[model samples]
Target: MGSTYRLQLRNQAKPTDPKHQPYRFESVLKVLNNGDEKLKSWKVFVGFRNDEYLVSASNAVLADGTSLPANVGNGTVFAGYPMTDLKTAIETAGDLNQIQVQVKLLGTQFGVKPPNVPLPETIQLANDVHLS
Candidate 1:
């Protein structure tokens, strides 16, 4: 069995006060088991970046749901950051479209065996997200 994963920017909390410089946002990461075999556990590494530098990076895990045998299931993880930093990064790079997100799946599942099996590797969720 194999799995599919995705990452996205969600749950945006903009500052109510215009004077507030830093806006806050969250990254929603999801993993979906698409094959017949049930997943034992999974982990992913995510990085948020702009053209010039990385804004934030995090590792997420799914151990509870994957403990049982099941098919066609999904898991989620969230990462958050301040908009002021992100905006500054983008501005310094001179392009709003330079914002991007990257994700990589760690090949070791908790209960899965056999080293020869292939595992999902990497995915890019967004090259540019329109921040309003």
Candidate 2:
């Protein structure tokens, strides 16, 4: 009945539990696109007790808080996709509150022209186009 927007997620490396110190992370959020072309970015209210907030491609926390080495921001902007198998990866890592997140994109960044991205033939299944 409606189109779905996919938000791809990747977890930055971080040390948590001594046993499960390293974790694999990823997420996809399917959002119901309203009539507007832009998706409103907001922190998911998963409810955890940390100063971390999703800024863009990486999650961030205020400077006064403990700085996590692996959780450093990557300066990449992204959007929210519908919660999919990605949620599983998140849950496996730990509590959502403990994870830092960032807003992937903004209004001006949304309508920009596409760069020359190389994709395989199979990858270009349908509406794919050459950027340059």
TM-score of each: 0.25, 0.21
Error of model 2, residue 57, in angstroms = 3.5
- Lowest lDDT 10-residue stretch of candidate 1: 45-54
Clash pairs (backbone) in predicted model 1:
23-83
lDDT of 1 by residue, 25-128 (tens): 22334433332332232333223221111133333322233321222113222222211112223234533322222233222122222233222243322212
The residue-level lDDT of candidate 2 at 108 comes to 14
Give the C-alpha miss distance for residue 19 in model 2, angstroms. 4.0
- Taking every candidate in turn, the Cα RMSD to the unseen true structure, in Å, is 20.1, 18.3
Lowest lDDT sum, 10 consecutive residues, model 2, at 118-127
Best of the candidates, TM-score? 1
Q: Give lDDT tens digits, candidate 2, residues 1-132.
A: 022223243232354444333323232222222222222332222211122233323332222233333222222212233221122223445333322223232111111122321111111101112112
RMSD of 1: 20.1
| lDDT agreement of model 1 with the native | 0.27
lDDT for 54 (candidate 2): 35
User: Considering every candidate listed, which one attains the maximal lDDT?
Assistant: 1
